[model samples]
Target: MYDVSNPHYMGDHTGTRKFRRVLLKLSGEALREPGSTDNISPPIVEDIAAQIKAAHQTGLEIAVVVGGGNFWRGVSASNKGMERATADYMGMLATVMNSLALQSMLEAMDVPTRVQSAIEMKNVAEPFIRRVATRHLELGRVVIFAAGTGNPFFSTDTTAALRASEVGADCVFKATKVDGIYCSDPNKNPDAVRFDTISFHDCLTKQLKVMDATAFSLCMENNMPIIVFSMNEPDNIRRALVGESMGTLVNASGKDA
Candidate 1:
């Protein structure tokens, strides 16, 4: 069990409590360190599990959407002449693998978890059912959604947005390598400006690449807010959940007419 004595307990009022329930979106690359092959590193998985456990202990309902970029990317495979649909299906399977690995880590920490796939894989996980997922959340099970909307050409970002809306999540936390959204690629341009808050419309007009067009459109249409933050920082996940002002907040409130 994690030492609750640490100051990072989830519900602490020192941090803002922006939302009641949240959907966390993680990329497949997050499972492994950069330049490593596709697979979940034990340390990384455990670290993420610990963070989720902390948030779970705070009595917040959490759900996750994981991507499959490490194992497969339909766009890249299609470039190699593989059929788009076939490549996408392969990507979906990769996400299932990631989901199972995450589930194992979360369960090891004694956090109850359920894996729900957009495509049916009864032997491995439950099919994507909105009510079932909601019930799982109500029961305090951390639900991990996999398979990227069960369709071709749609990115996992879209899946996260859709799942967040369906589960009635107050916001979607997009865990990324960077601390927040910037005016330019932070790595490429050291002087790039980071936005504490940005409107979805401005992000779209600026082509900020916070998320793909489809996902951004879905969130904008639904008025769902998304918080982009760094996953590398140990307590960042808990911080974001508790509404600490740590990353970029993108929503309708920040949107410009």
Candidate 2:
């Protein structure tokens, strides 16, 4: 169990009210280091669990949605003649694997975690239920949503947005390798400028690739702010939760004002 009595609580002084609840979206690749064949690296899992534990200790309710790209991508495979439904099912299974690994890591750190899947896999996780998930959060257990909405065509990003809306999360945090949204591909364009904040309309107009069109639209329509930031940096997850102003904040308004 995470010791809630620890004195290392980092405070946020940005005057922005802290989010009461948040949805964190993790990509499958984040469970491993770059260019590695391993599906679940022990160090990466430990690091993530530690960050999540810290944030949870601060009294913010959290829910997670993980992608299955590290093991497979149903849509990508379907383009090569694989049956779309079958490929999607495989992708859902992959997400379950990632969710289990994450749950184990968080539990090892005493963070109290639960895994819920869209498709019923009674042997592994509970079938996703909105009320049950809300109860878990209220009771201080981290809820990890898996299986991608139990649908074939939708991506996990869409699932994250949908779940955030369903659970009334105040914001969605997208953990990426990059620190923030840039004007262009930061890797190729060294001079790409990073935005401290951005509007949903501007992101769509500029064709920003922070998230898919479907996910972005859902969040926009519902007035949910999404933050994109680097998970590779130590303590970034906790910092973001505390309103550190380290990521690109996407909201409905044209500006933060």
Candidate 3:
């Protein structure tokens, strides 16, 4: 068993070889086509799966944590009068749906896949077990972590960091709408500067919102690196897997290699 808690466990972060294992964090919006009423788009999922398939072909162990913002946002629903816990639970169900869709597409592409849900639904997905998930990855099976840590008030971003730390992943790859982290919201600030690399301490001190506070804290505490990059870029997933340096990397040191 890979002991992530061991003090001397220096993950495969040498950048001397291809990443041994990584956790990809994808938002639910990635599955929905913009300007379309549909909540889930097959073509978008297929595109994402194709890139992942190409990367998996390289023998890199891949695990994914998918968010549920497309179908539901717990905080948004709660603010509209629904109970917070109930709204969060509904959000968890949404992630399960997205996970199943991605799994179907990856399997259709002949890539072995598994969906592990934190909130178990026996007929559809296996209950999340750390050892089992690690074993699946070791066997070269792609594992999609769904249901957001089986608890309310925890964002999927936090789940990504937590899972990466638990599984001894080399880094957390955040597939987002933006190309990388910027000094400000690039859309709003035309002059916002993008950093090739930034330190976790700087990210906090500067209030760069690469992720939620809890997620950032978790990654920092675990010394897990995060790569923030755009999912819309063609073959970006594969590029990231092979360490082609396309996005902003957040780590202990603020320097890019």
Top candidate (lDDT) = 3
- Winner on lDDT between 2 and 3 is 3
lDDT of 3 by residue, 1-257 (tens): 12123243233444422468899999999999999999999999999999999999988899999999999999999999999999999999999999999999999999999999999799999999999999999999999999999999999999999999998898899999899999999999999999988888898899988799889889989888888998887898788866666678787777644
By TM-score: ranked, best first: 3, 2, 1
Estimate the Cα RMSD of every predicted model relative to the unseen true structure: 5.7, 5.5, 3.8
What are the per-residue Cα lDDT tens digits for candidate 1 across 1-257?
11111122233444354456789999999889767764678888888888888988888899999999878899999999999999999999999999999999999989999999999989999999999999999999999999989999999999999999899888889999999899999999999999977877888988998799889889988888788999888889887776676788787657312
Compared with the true structure, all predictions reach lDDT values of: 0.85, 0.86, 0.88
Candidate 2 displacement at residue 256 in angstroms: 1.9
**By the TM-score metric, which is better: model 2 or model 3?**
3
Question: Number of clashes in every candidate structure?
Answer: 0, 0, 0
Off by over 4 Å in 1: 1-15, 255-257
The digit string of per-residue lDDT tens for model 2 on 72-101 reads 999999999999999999999999999999
Q: Which residue pairs show backbone clashes in model 2?
A: none
Query: What lDDT is reached at residue 46 by model 1?
Result: 84
- Indicate the residue-level lDDT of 42 in model 2: 84
